[model samples]
Target: MKRGRLALGIIGALALGLGGSVVALRAGAGETDRAELEKRWADAPSRFVTVDGVRMHVREEGPANGPVVVLLHGSIVNLHEWDDVVPLLADKYRVVRFDWSPYGLTGPDPSGFYSTPRSAQLMDGLMKALGHDKFAMVATSNGANVGLEFNRAYPGHVTAMAFSMLPLERPSQTRKVDWRLKWMLEAHKAVLPNWRHREFWRLMLEDTTPPEFTPTDRMVDQITEMNNLPGALDRQAQYIQANVRAFQSSDVGAVAEAVRVPVLLQWCSFDDVISQSADASVKRFTNTKVDVINYPDLGHFPMWEKPEKFTRDLRNWLDRQPPAPAG
Candidate 1:
């Protein structure tokens, strides 16, 4: 009886302390200085469209008549991931870059409907709204898987496809060797106490790329700001948990064997997330000739780390491909 009373007293004290702290914090943050808050959100890009009542943010450039290139950014990154590459491609292709639903400036899916099929449907609507019938595509990591599913679902719409740092299958060498083992090793090293800490912006930027190509301070700041937006972190966590299966289940070999359009598979030799073995496996299934570009020192984000090389290779590949026949 005495112990039970003591436990209750401790619980009450903790509750009181927590409640007081919350009240003090709220009082200190009253109204939030509207001008300052506005300045903080000032860098967020404008919205392009609202599909199914969810706003989609896009950044478009280049001549309207030029060939279209739809860019799909990786998980946790906004369209700005293509900032360096887009400008270069924009002059040649009508470049359309957008934040996926429930990411970046687009915000979260209020209905909790986040999946590859749903995202693909949203992209289909977005492309039509933007007056595009067929377009080329470039995607990395989670975006690459989304692009693959999109291409499979809408083959008539995607003309050519490029994938960077994408996993091919579940329980493969990459999955077993790269992710699972690495996670365990890192955990043993005490590098991250929790998976959420693994998502830290500084660690992602610093640890996942070539030293020479570390993201600029401005780029890091932009990414971090987007991450801190209301509901952004939660949305990212949900996306990772929900969509990781897509990466695991992706039959890149089957897709490659079935793909009729030209394809490009690029990877960084030192990629920490998706292993090079997976790249080799995916390459084996291509019906059309695969243009494999390998970067030795870069990590998972080769597009950002080696923008010039990636752009040049992409342009060369695009130039060599025969134009699509008219419908």
Candidate 2:
């Protein structure tokens, strides 16, 4: 066979093998109890609050009157995504984190709304309820999207924001999701619920990382355990689908154009997705006070993979900003 045909054959074989792996590992896979999962993740200031009909898990730290710093995590992760970085800020800033809809201990959305506007409103309410008026935010991936919306809706309330990444340009005119890729994700929504816990962790950690970073077995085990929590996948699937529509709407990118506060854009050296966006953000925010920090050796989750470096860089930026408003 020719080289092109030979490569095609190998690709097909790998795809088939991956499918087989999912099915084989799914056998006897059982869901975990919600109570057990919640018990494991929620601790020390982590508790549930009914925010606009959604019961979200929130954790706050530092003095009740300190400058507020809200940590917003990425997709498929929870408030605890800040576990490595929160301690660094908690001593001085009033650090707050919360489990968003269909992720972490928060569970599904009671309102069935997963768009940026809905999420931004919910976050605003959460801050007000906590007695924080002006605050700073550390937002990653999906959370960064919501953070942009929050800043747009309530510009005065947001003093500064550190974005893991963002795109300043408008989205492509082409169809957002290819039919084949969309079909695969939609099909796996069911398979994911039944798929082996380890497989879920592997797929999530599969990309968006530097080539040499090796996730420990312990890290994989912990993520797998959280993913395998009962009812988690079901809620995950629901939010995933809704979020797909939200992406097409480009609400996050649209909101970015209006953000007037100081922003720290953190970029991953090897990340193919966010670097371009980071550059575009510079152009879009020409009139605003914006700074960039390139993580030369890091990946998507810098705070998780390189907490010391991430927190140090973040502190350098945070310390330069104006003091937080008196509580």
Candidate 3:
């Protein structure tokens, strides 16, 4: 047999084995109750607000009268990603962070609707519930996409936006995959709802960060427990698919050009996943005052990896901006 054929045979065997294992694991998996998760994750300053019928888990810090700043975490992660930066911003700004459904203690949305547009709507509703009319936004990864969508839908509501690891183009569109192997991806998504292995979460974290940045055991536990929540896996899969559809159907250039507020682009040098979009993102923000800063050593989650530096840089940039009228 040809070497290529042999390699293909091995790949086929591995795929079959993995798929079978996933199905078996899924059969035995059970969902954890939201009430139980709340006990473990929710604490001081944590509150739930009904936004568009979905209960949102949110935290507010700093002075109530201070300038408002909202923090948006990336996909598959909760608001805790900014645990280190919240206090720093809270010193002068009324910093707010929240967990989107299916990702944090917020649990899953009953509607199962997940997309950037929907997230933007939820955000607007959440802000109104909190009595915030306008605010600055610090968003990462998919959250940045939500921020952009929010700004486009409600112009002048966002005074400024700072984005890191912004994916101007969705990965599915950029990384072309063979149609023959697509089912493997689908099977993985199907299996996620039943998956509850901490090692798997640990591996994912390690793969995204530098070798030196070992994800703590607590981090692994948190992620595992969150994903294992009842209905979270299914909702997360739907969210991923919805996001891809939104990106595919919408014009990214139009969205970026629509942004009129001051912008900050914190591009990471080592995040091979989305770094390619960095230069393109800056150029797309032709209508706004965009400040580009490259972190030569950072990976995907720069804020999580170096909160102090991230917060300091953000503060300095924000201080330089002339105060704009609140919405």
Per-model RMSD to reference: 7.2, 6.8, 6.3
Q: After superposition, how far is residue 182 of candidate 2 from its true place, in Å?
A: 13
Q: Indicate which candidate wins on TM-score.
A: 3
Backbone clashes counted, model 1: 0
Candidate 1 has its poorest 10 consecutive residues by lDDT at 191-200
Per-residue lDDT for 1-327 in model 2, tens only? 699999999999999998787766565345566787667777667777888887778998887777888889877667767888988887888888887666677756667656556778888888888778888888987788778878888778888889874534322334233454455556655675443446546545645566677666655665666666665666666655666666666544556667777889887765554535566667766447889988778777787788888898998899889867745
Q: Write the per-residue lDDT of candidate 3 for residues 1-327, one digit (tens) a residue.
A: 699999999999999998787666676554556787777777778889988688899999988888888899988788888888888777778888998655787745667688778888888888888988878888988888888888888777788889887877775344433443344445455555455566566766765666677777767777777877766766777888887776678765468888888899887776766734666778888887789888877777787678788788989988777643332
What is the overall TM-score of model 3 with all chains considered together?
0.84
Q: What is the lDDT of candidate 1?
A: 0.68
The regions of model 3 sitting more than 4 angstroms off are 1-30, 172-193, 323-327
lDDT by residue (1-327, candidate 1, tens digit) is: 999999999999999997785555334421233234235533444345877777778767877778888899987677878888987887768888898876667746667878766787788878878778888888887787677777777778888888776755532343324354356546523532222222345556666676676567766665656665555555666666566666566544365555668888776777766644744655655566666777787777777787898888878887776643221
As a whole number from 0 to 100, the lDDT of residue 247 in candidate 1 is: 53
Clashes counted in candidate 3 amount to 0
CA lDDT scores, all candidates in order: 0.68, 0.72, 0.77
